[model samples]
Target: MKKTLLSLLAVVTCAYSAPALASGGTEAPPHVHWEFSGPFGTYDRAALQRGLKIYREVCSSCHAVKHLAFRNLTDLGYNEEQVKAIAAEYTVTDGPDEDGEMFERPARPSDRFPSPYPNENAAKAANGVAPPDLSLIVKARHHGANHVFGILTGYEEAPEDHPLADGQHWNKYMPGHVIAMAKPLSNGQVTYEDGTIETVEQYAQDVAQFLAWASEPDLEARKRFGISALIFLAVFAGVMYRLKKAVWKDVH
Candidate 1:
């Protein structure tokens, strides 16, 4: 009878603990297939360009890619002249003048991408929480692309019993299913010159990829080099094996 009671108590404890375990903390974001996921993977230049557009039109208002330079856009298949033209679009504040006052000037190719807000306080004042700098966000987060992708698409209605704080929205993938930022994308949010569908999912995927590239700009080149080195090692090993066989043939 005691064993039966203990077993019943254990089952009830597990039943109660299951929901708590599932929803108690920041949930792992859903996995999504990425073109740049594997050793041989490469970034899609077209997608990066599209993602840049989305970032400029939507995310730039809040989040900032402060470390990525305008010149880095060249990795997205942009030429020098095009990069210069793109860089000219944004103005960033420069050093103090003769009067000891800071001045603003047009951004140059060499300049780091400017933050949307001048400082952390300003960013926080504008949006309750200061938006995170996205420069190394991909590297900073585990399963970075998937996490960002999931967050972008995870906003949804909370269950009836789930309570949310004021100014917070429900995001199943976020910690406690609560987030300060609202859904930032919707259908037809951004029009693609290439005529790709303007969808939240598409935007999330593209921008996530762009962020990945920003985090590891040379990932493709590095992967290529790694592949070349592996090929050379295999060929060298075969040659060495054959040479050994030849050298030992007489002894055998």
Candidate 2:
């Protein structure tokens, strides 16, 4: 335990002390910093929608969201009809015949979304890398939002002058940060219907938020319950105090 703690401390110290630069500059780039700011505070409907769009268009090519059901879209503020329409967009496998052949059908509220690749090996073969399953990625990954933002925006080619780390490749911030994946987003990658330019950084932020929220769909309900519990307790206490005083006055 002592050795592990010391090693962690040393790594953290190095990471902090090393001259870290954000993508496109010598300075660290702006990222969406996450914190516990109530349930509603963390949610931005627009960001979630945009993130969904990015996931559908870009990251879905590699990652699978196996844990999420099509019905869960309602939690993200989509109405049932909207959720149904969205679910219908994806094809899910169905039916068990005597020959046991698989068939593709439109996604339903009950069906889980199908992955782009059949498995990790297939994903690697197709994309030159294994696309990660994003079921609970926001919850599972370390320093999630920061990591996501950093990885998405941080893709600089290593300079010949800089020394490379053993496993590292040419990355924007670190030397030899050879990320297997190519930069998915650049400026003007997605031409939004509203004319908003889809920059890589923006997509990163939105998708991170979406994944974070998807991992915790009960966030809004949890917040609401917490608030209600506090209010109920306060009101009950007030009523109890008044009742005790009234009963004691008659006795006195």
Q: What TM-score fits each model?
A: 0.87, 0.73
Q: Candidate 2 overall Cα lDDT vs. reference?
A: 0.74
What tens digits encode model 1's per-residue C-alpha lDDT throughout 1-252? 999999999999999878658667666888888889889888989999999999999999999998899999999999999999988999988889999999989899999888899899999898788989887888987668898898999998988898877778999787577888989999998999998998999999999999999899989889999999999999999999999999999999
Best by lDDT: 1
lDDT, residue 90, model 2: 90
What would the TM-score be for candidate 2 when compared with the true structure? 0.73
Residue-level lDDT tens digits of model 2 in 1-252: 999999999999988766443222343434465543444454777777787888888888878988888887776678999888989999987887668987778998888878988878998877666867887886875455566677788877677787655434455532235666667778777656655557887788878888887777777678888889999999999999999999899798
Point out where model 1 deviates above 4 Å.
1-27
Ten-residue stretch with the least lDDT total in model 2? 21-30
Model 1 / residue 86 / CA error / Å: 1.4
Worst 10 residues of 1 by lDDT: 19-28
